[model samples]
Target: MIELGVLFGLLAAAVLALIFVLLRRGNGSTENADGLLVEQARRLQAHNDRVSYNAASVRSSSPTTTDHYRP
Candidate 1:
């Protein structure tokens, strides 16, 4: 019974150690992180551009309060 408990503790410790080692190995370089930032900036700029275009289209096609209430 004592040996079984010791074995289970060692197994849990080894699994935790393996997880820590893998996470440490996955720490990437500055270049990869910078590339991610640049990609996000590009996506944001494209979204802004699309929103601007749609806003202009809606402004042109939709009527104003004055137009709606005009005699």
Candidate 2:
């Protein structure tokens, strides 16, 4: 039973080490990171603009408070 526990502990440690190395290797350069962030920001802005335009259109098409009160 003790040997089994030790084996599992070593396996877990090896997995953690692999994960750490892969993460470090995948980080890439700062310029690439900056570009990715900029692209993400642009996409976010476009999404926000589209949502705002759609919300405005919906608001314009809907009935007004005065119309509701009259009805």
Candidate 3:
């Protein structure tokens, strides 16, 4: 009877350890995904800013039809 009790205790401890490790791994993966998304968003915003700046510069430097249509 004493041997049976020791076996059950060991089994329970092993199962608990496995569950803890799996849960920790699942959380780590979620954090990694979140970090990747944040990095991508930062890069997208930088690209958009550059494009907007270029467009504004082009508009300011180009001549308009109004310049030639005045009486």
Candidate 4:
């Protein structure tokens, strides 16, 4: 139908306009900053140690005992 042709032309024009708008706005962001990613990789590797730990472990410091508390 002639109506169908007109509809397709309108849809194609809208899509082309949207593509131009996006091209002008350009692309988006970076996931990491500079050497931070490299340092993080090193830290992650160091953290991969066999010791089992979770958030609670990170929050707690080592237990401290004085001579008076000797077993």
What local lDDT does model 2 show for residue 67? 48
lDDT of model 1 at residue 11? 100
Model 1: residues >4 Å from true position, as ranges?
27-71
- Candidate 3's C-alpha lDDT? 0.78
Q: How accurate is candidate 2 locally (lDDT)?
A: 0.80
- Whole-model alpha-carbon lDDT for candidate 1: 0.80
Residue pairs clashing in model 4 are: none
Question: 17-52, model 4: which lDDT tens digit per residue?
Answer: 999999998866556686678888988877875234
Q: Which stretches of candidate 3 lie over 4 Å from their true place?
A: 27-71
Candidate 3 per-residue lDDT over residues 1-71, each given as its tens digit: 99999999999999999999998877444535878899899999999888777744756644433454458
Residue 2, model 2: Cα distance from true site in angstroms: 0.5
Model 1 lDDT tens row, 1-71: 99999999999999999999999889776655878899899999999888777744656644333454447
lDDT of 2 by residue, 40-67 (tens): 9999999988877773475665443344
**Candidate 1 deviates by what RMSD?**
9.0
TM-scores of the candidates are 0.38, 0.38, 0.38, 0.38
